[model samples]
Target: MKLKKFIISSLLAFASLTFTSNADAASVQTHRVQKGDTLWKIGMNYGVSVSQLKRENHRTSDLIYIGEILKIPQTISAYEKDLLARLVEAEAKGEAYAGKVAVATVVLNRVDSDLFPNSISEVIYQKDQFTPVKNGTIYNPASEASKKAVNEALVFRGQGSGSLYFYNPQKTSNSWLRSKQVTVVIGNHVFAK
Candidate 1:
């Protein structure tokens, strides 16, 4: 009787382990490291941080073997991409392509800023933050250009000039925004910190 109980317990443990690893496998993908590849570049392609890659692979250094199979975490969710794409569409309509990309970068910059919320949703929906949200334009569907711009923004993440704000000089009468130093003038929008 004792032996039978031991066998059942061991089987249960094996089953639990198998299930857990399979669940993780669904979200984690393997990448065979290639020549001329840097951790930073790999992280950019996969929309993950270098630290996350290193931690996932159990490495203490940035060094990776050319043939090593690295476990890459899943990329940003579809919902986040869709939300960002929609925002860029509403905010950068009629603006240059560069302006659209820059607009998305500003939202990502806010997500990384200490002064703003740490999430895209929180930063976008914060009280009186964006005119589109208030005007109900944020709900509009995104365009292909805006969606592509969002993807490009993710690839070039952290390309922000510490810019946390953007506005059209001819449209906005906000003295506070005007007082801030301008970083880039793309199309009709003035990107600023």
Candidate 2:
């Protein structure tokens, strides 16, 4: 009876090990860097941030060479995801559905940009960056549309490629913003690089 119990335990342990190894293998995906690929672009494609990519790959710099392999992290923290949804709701309330997604895309674009912060919270809360945060509208509950838009933005990256700034042409008199080349105009806002 003791030998029988021991054999059963050994089989269970082996099955557990086999399942864990398979799960880990399924979770990880490798990407070979292309000539024109930047870490920002790669992260966007995988719904990850450049910093997360760097940390996962042990990369000290943004530099990546052609043919370099990178592991893409598939999960984002719940807090960060909620923050994005809130920002989208506050910023794009009353706007068209596409416009809401576009707004979220711009925030993601900024996170990927060298000129802006590397995270969602930092990009949204940067001084004078987002009006919703300044006016405390960001604390309001996110609309269903806004939440969906954020998820769509994550799945379909680069929808706002080369766009880092967006403003209502009617509300802003900032000469600097006016000078930026417009990438797209959705609803009432103008997106620019």
Candidate 3:
């Protein structure tokens, strides 16, 4: 009876080890960032967050130079932790930080929509999705206001009314946009649901 019990235990342990090894093998994959590849795009591809990429790579700025090698996390939990940490840091920077997070959130929303790419990186790097990233906004050094907006959005996270749309009232005179749902009015930006 003791031999039989020992054999069963050994089999169980072997099975557990095999499962663990398989799980670990499936958990991580390597990615090389090519020219025009944004962290957001990579995160989207790996189902992680831009912040996660930044944290994993110890990046202090969102401006990812060309050919930066990044390790993409394979799990949503790890990605969320990375994003939350980055958001917290951005909030510490102020409104501009908040705006950045909010901007990230908008990309995330688009990812959820069938009309947009299925990942953060893809949505952010999508044609005309973000002007700052495409036109050198990320490299322009986030403004105090932009930083603050980023922090606020990170903390607010879909809590400030339902406004998911935003535009510069001065730059855009589109009447249709004006008719959209307005959620939060912060600084020079207006957020709509």
Q: Provide TM-scores for the models.
A: 0.75, 0.64, 0.44
Looking at model 1, the pairs that clash are: none
Count of backbone collisions within predicted model 3: 33
Per candidate, the number of residue pairs that clash is: 0, 0, 33
Q: Best TM-score goes to which candidate?
A: 1
Deviation in Å, model 2, residue 163 alpha carbon: 0.9
* lDDT (Cα, tens digit) per residue for candidate 2, span 1-193: 9999999999999999999999999879889999899987876566665767787899889999999889887645678878998999988899999899888889888887899998888988999899988899999889878877886677555434678889998999999998999989999999998
C-alpha RMSD by candidate, in order? 4.2, 9.2, 13.9
Estimate the lDDT of model 3.
Answer: 0.56
Predicted candidate 3 versus true structure: per-residue lDDT over 1-193, tens digit per residue: 9999999999999999999999997766768768878765666456555655677778888777666567665443444434433432332234444455555455445555677777655655567544454555333344445434433333333333444456678768979878888766655666675
Instruction: Determine which window of 10 residues in candidate 1 has minimal summed lDDT.
Output: 151-160
In terms of lDDT, model 2 sits at 0.84
- Order of the predicted models by lDDT, top scorer first: 1, 2, 3
In candidate 2, residue 89 scores what lDDT? 90
